[model samples]
Target: MDYLMCHIEKEFFGTTFEGIPIYQYTLVNKNGAMVKIITYGAIVRELWVPGRSGTLFDVVLGFDSLQEYEEKNASYFFGAIVGRYANRIAGGSFKIDGVTYQLALNDGDRPNALHGGVKGFYTRVFKAIPMKTPKGPSLVLKYLSHDGEEGYPGNLDVTVIYTLTNENELKIEYRATTDKPTVVNLTHHSYFNLSGDGTILDHEIMINADHYTPVDENLIPTGEISSVEGTPYDLRSFKRLEDAIEPLKDTPTRGFDINYVLNGKDGELKLAAVLKSKKTSVRMEVYTTEPGLQFYTGNFLDVKGKGGKYYSPYSGLCLEAQHFPDSPNHSNFPSTILRPGEEYRQITVYKFSMEG
Candidate 1:
């Protein structure tokens, strides 16, 4: 495996309310693929992958300058780790072992904790440690969440490793341990625009999910496992995202933003979804050990992105692998609780290739 790492001096928006300076590290693979990540929020600044013609194009939406990211509120979250809890917690509250805990509500009057609240892991700057492995160059990021930081229990120490292998696989391994029992569901939120030129509506997507969690008007799951058959949510087989997005444009969020129950065994890696962009002939295969995948079509990206373009809705898509939303509240869903004796581990891989 070919391992490559280079340190470049680049400035970025700071973590505090007052803008500060941050650095960016670029990791490139032998296949001419590369990912630029910054220390601020550990955000993925850009990602370039090879196309069918053996050309490289930036596929992830991001900003060119720190000022742009600060002013626009346009955090593609691009390729950052989201955690504590990956999805929404109803009313910013959940009961664990008969103990009710209140969380920080940041989802705009929804009264629910969305994506780990206002000061989520995405908003924190992680400590990056670069390592050389047999497969490739990897970066291990560690973050410590103090008890009651986000109104959750325990002091959580989380580690996420980003490894770009020689086989064109971007593997993310998540590990965490808490001093007290807590809810932990972490995933990498990478907005992907495989076509590299236009919106993701034309991209063909195939999700191996026969059921999905029905959401309310606020985009919170109603704790029901509804069949995806005959609905716009159906993607059991390969289908263009545009074909099913037109009708749902009038819904609450106005796009495909829902969690799908993966039809596979838990705790074992299995194919989650396959995405192909005909324009660039770029294909990506997603595999994970999680039980569910959240498909978000960049429903709120109307803000300005890099290069003076207002990123319209559906400009990018994210497939986050994790346990179902509100799993702590829903007994039917997979358990997301991690006691002191148990360890949390999850692995997800995005393998890129091109179609002839």
Candidate 2:
């Protein structure tokens, strides 16, 4: 909690509707690594690291102004924490022990509730506090989702910790407790362009999953776990996103927006994916304790981002770590229900480096 020793700084970010103040906090490690987070939605505004040539540059895509983030178009989740249910829920309804709870259908014509029924955690303000660990400088953000906040059950208290380690790892830890039975899945939404401001099509990517959940036309899982072999979904080995996306660009959805069943024990933090931008010589290794990772290419990403840069489709990508989408609707998938006493926890790490 010692700010001086941790080298954490705080400043004014902006104000919300009622003119309440919002703040931004910057964490710096001894190795010149930096991470910027804001109280609004506990969003990660910028993540900077050194490239192969030892020059620091921002790797995560976002906006310079909070207004741009607040009005981030229809597809702009932008480096914030998404929750309640991090992905899609079919028909916006789920039953728990014979009681059916209906949610809002927010995914356009899909007739599904997407990312916590619209006003998800990404749309709310979080109480942010700074603290440091032996591993690095950290920021802890807390939020209390009142009972029936988004047609979901129970009053949920959630905390998310973002740590910038000296080893160039951005570690995210999530914890939530509910008073009644409820479904909760949380993850970070960051459009990562390792080259910083260019199309991410050329990034070399590899995922450790051999199976994936196939979605219907509406992008809802058909409750089938299919093999990725011989398919463009097969990212078992390193493949250029340009090549992987080429075959699927014609699809109605336009690019890769699939969810991979992470290969490992449910709660063990294991390697999920590795991304390298040869253009910038910047590499990122993704590790997580969650069972599923949603790999979303910026297929519909048309919006103004930092420095007035216009981001287009395939400009950036997201590797969201959490439970599978619509877990409440599928009995076979890993359960996402959190009862009175059971707690929910997930950890994900994004380690950055250069070709060394």
Candidate 3:
């Protein structure tokens, strides 16, 4: 077989606390966009996209060292792949097949099970495989979650493939299967600052959704699919993030952290949102198969990131595409249940372009 050549460079990253060796795979597309993925947390350490002037900018927030990511990623999530359940679950508990399961109450005093519990997929090291493809270079990460690992039933096998396409798209494909009945909602958590520096408040954004799931004080969905019309949750038109986040400055969230019900057929990939940075003339278009898009301003980001830069609140923004929060508890929301013999699959693409 003739070996196909692709722009994928693998290098040693660092060791985990348990002395586990970690590796980073750098995938470069034909157009020069780059994405670096590490085995630890199956995280995207950095993503470089080109601006209008052809200057490549690292748009995602990350750490300089493995120790920093290990110590601080829990607070901000960074570029990790979060799962089991992407968002909050009410009271840290849910019922599956008439059996109640209690997950770790890791969401501080709010007492909700956030992101699969204390040891979510973001904390686990995955086995990586790099492959050259016609479309681009791909890095496949595989992880096995044992039954009852995070108070969840069934042993879930997960595979996440990150492909850097020639179209300047960072495509993430998620697939999972379980031996028993389980609920799964996997999503990427990457804090993006399209300008590559400073806050994301000035970025213009638009979401292709006419409805949103309103959250309560704890940030859990209120079980009602409310219309985005005449509401602050509306992002149907492009507007500066500063204008959208300013109204909630005194509220409990302090910024946008609600989930917008994506306007499309669930399970079908469609345009979810678009974020633009006027400073760099870079635009990011998000397309996903998930039914909801969580637009979270970095409301609680007060940590220092790579290059010794201090990131204050609203330093970046996250467009997390996944199922609605507390979907297992919300009967009306799209189902996230995955039973034996059923394969859970989702695809999300972040395509970048220069709009001068």
Best by lDDT: 3
Q: Could you tell me every candidate's TM-score relative to the true structure?
A: 0.93, 0.97, 0.98
Query: Poorest 10 consecutive residues of model 3 by lDDT?
Result: 1-10
Report backbone clashes per prediction: 0, 0, 0
RMSD of each candidate relative to the true structure: 2.3, 1.6, 1.5
lDDT score, candidate 3: 0.92
TM-score ranking, high to low? 3, 2, 1
How do the residues 120-213 of candidate 3 rate in per-residue lDDT, one tens digit apiece? Answer: 9889999999998888889999999999998999999999999998888999999999999999999999999999999999999999999999
Best by TM-score: 3
Q: List the residue pairs that clash in candidate 3.
A: none
Against the true structure, candidate 1 reaches a TM-score of 0.93
Q: Write the per-residue lDDT of candidate 2 for residues 250-353, one digit (tens) a residue.
A: 99878899899999998999999999998889999999999999999999888878888898998889999989988898999999999998889989999999
Score residue 4 of candidate 2 by CA lDDT. 42
On TM-score, the stronger of 1 and 2 is 2
Residue 146 of model 2 has an lDDT of 96
The CA-based lDDT of model 2 is what? Answer: 0.89
Name model 3 segments beyond 4 Å from true.
1-5
